[model samples]
Target: MKKSIYRLIKFSILPLLFICYAIYITGKNTGDFYKRFSSPQQNSLILGSSRAASMNPEIIDQIIHSKYPNAKLYNYAFTWAHSPYGPKYLESIEKKIKPDTKDGVFIVTVEPTALMVDKNKPDDPQYYTENDKSVAKTSMVATNPNLEYLLESYDFSITNEFNKKIRPEKNPMIEVSVLDNGQVHGKVIKRFSTEKRKEVNAEKMAELKNRINELKISPTRLEYLSKTIDFLKQHGKVMVVRMPVSKVPYDIENSAVADFDKIILDITESKKVPYINYNNYPNNYQWVDEVHLEPEFMDKFSAVIAKDLVH
Candidate 1:
């Protein structure tokens, strides 16, 4: 038994030693990825779920460069992000994250889910793990291949970029439908790109909407929405805008969104921030389905967001 125990320790030590060695050797990459990724620039910053990421940063940067000239842009967009996640991420990196050195403008798209969540999920601890853990090495991902293991092992919230590998394998959350010249048009399809997800999303969002309606929770979905607004109060100037959606998805979810509008009005009123509910705007025939932008509309939509709050 003593010999066996010693052998076990010896074997375990090798892997542990290797991990430490990997970190020590390639610490720069891990250190830099986290610092650079989290550090905010002086221009504008965009955050949210797919919508923010789905919108092209290239075009946004270009426009900011042209208009603001000195504006620095950073893509802090995270996939599968919700309210609590956004607020938490901002707070965690607030000091490191800056929005336009000269101007204090931040644009964050609001989704209906931002208000309500189960408040319990694997992604929760997952985000905590990634952000909480010290990532001081660059080749960390390389040595610790299987990012999924790193995620589950550390229970890191999928909210942080580290868990990106575990993102749904099907449809990417965001994509560019039209990229012409310097303008970009992006689209948000469902999570799973499989034919099954594609076929069922319309129905799925409908059913999901119904289930939530039965619960009759306020737009905060429990407390996420309220918490989010409260958290953003100190993060410079904030604009929480609800992007346009098609009639099908909008109508089904309008009641909840109406409640959301009230919450937005309340937050903006108290915080002196701007919140635009764009559902009142006419649909430009660019919505591919009920919840996404067609190729043509994204550019116009991106420009609208830029024009409205970017100053």
Candidate 2:
């Protein structure tokens, strides 16, 4: 009996220690937003999906600083499902803005899908979708990190950790390193030929075009977005923008959601917020994928955004 008890303790303790070690290594790279939640001190915030993640806050600030010398921009963007309607956006707002934050600028970039029901997944239990729940969990951990967060950081395989240590690749999914100003350098790791991607997307457009009413802009999202705008307005000016994508994907988006721009315009006009659709801008920019901007173009894009904000 003593031998049996000793064996149990030996087995349990070893596994526990291993798990603790895994968590420690995995937790090392929790991304930038998680790091910022501890003390989210900033003057300007750029909020949106993956496209917004590609923005360089440092470049945007440099371009705008001449006009507002003290201005700062923090890119607080996550990937899919981090929509304005979601709890992540609200939680981030709560974390980033304090009662004393009297003056700031809130730039919100919108993707059509952000307002449309995904129809591909369960919608209840807010911020608990598979893709976003872990991210939201990770970000919330920043407020008060604990053992659970440590566990959440653990990957089942140590090989993944080993590979990273041996050859650290900037996580193609989320920026591995974030600057103090919350600038994330998300890179475009892969791309498909524009014509080929467009051809593939055309079929997707057909499916969506038929489901317009079923997948129409979510009223619930609009309501929450308005709430976010109202909250930001009390603290600072608000700007709504639709970032640029390639022409083919842009056309497909239009086909998928009719009058999408009109709806956005109505909302912005009602709220008296400035709205810019960079799609309408000259097609001088380049794309890494059908939807994301190339890194080289970000500086020029940031300059354009700065000019728009200043005006």
Candidate 3:
């Protein structure tokens, strides 16, 4: 009986060791592959959902470096990253900031839907797909600056050849490229013709409207936002920004969330932080879709915000 038990233990331990080694190798390869894609600096952080991902760190840095030469900004935003994830993410990246770092500016884009909560409803998996890469995987490597964290969080799906093949074209509606500076450039994928683009935009806009209608600002999320502000204040100045959507969708969102500005204003005012609302951007800046601007306008938008930030 003892011999049989020992044999079982030997077999189990060998398989466990092999699994551990595989995890380590998979993580090392993928982590190194993605390391070429993100920045190492962290004096400034851009935080929000996909909206905040649009801000180009290089463009913003160019505008501010003359005034604050030492400032290094990294876009830390991810898709479907709302208030629920913000506080934890901020905490996770604390070690990345240098001990002597000062004048660290944190720009956070406030998306209205992030404030809402519906406990009874489960989130759509499509809303939070890790079809290609996981922010948590890349982020763990970024903040910890080690292989262990990266290995522990690595998803096995990344190893699948089928997943790799489709990753480049994941999310046919919006194609995003995350650069070394952590700036994510997203383009609306217009397949065949202008008519197809219009059709896609209309469907997305309708879905967004439906989601907006069901949104209810949760007290818990508001509390989390408040905590996030307080936590960020420990590092440096904080700015709350409201990014612009196209006219029709913007108007619909405004009508749905009556106290949107008021809520943001109250938080900023109480926290003594600045709030920049670009919801009324001039007609000249073109939009790729209801919520995102075309790449041509990204630099202009970043310039506007960076100018304000430096001043």
Model 2 weakest lDDT span, ten residues long = 125-134
Please give, for residues 131-173, the per-residue lDDT of candidate 3 as tens digits: 2244433444353234444454434443433344446445576
As for lDDT, the candidate ahead, 1 or 2, is 2
Residues 175-218, candidate 2: write the lDDT tens digits. Answer: 35555565555544655577876776676556544544345456
Model 2: lDDT equals 0.65
Candidate 3 worst ten-residue window by lDDT: 29-38
The 10 consecutive residues of candidate 1 with the worst lDDT sum are: 133-142
Model 1 segments beyond 4 Å from truth? 1-43, 65-67, 79-87, 92-96, 99-104, 119-201, 214-237
- lDDT tens readout by residue for model 1, 1-311: 99999999999998888665543332222312232222323344565555554565555556655555654445444433222243354453343344324443466677665444443333342333224332311223223233433433333332333223346336566644222111223445545556755577667677757655643323323244445445544544567778788776777666665676776677677767788878887756554545667655666777777776557
Query: How high a TM-score does candidate 1 get?
Result: 0.56
C-alpha displacement of 167 in model 3, angstroms? 12
Clashes of each: 17, 0, 0
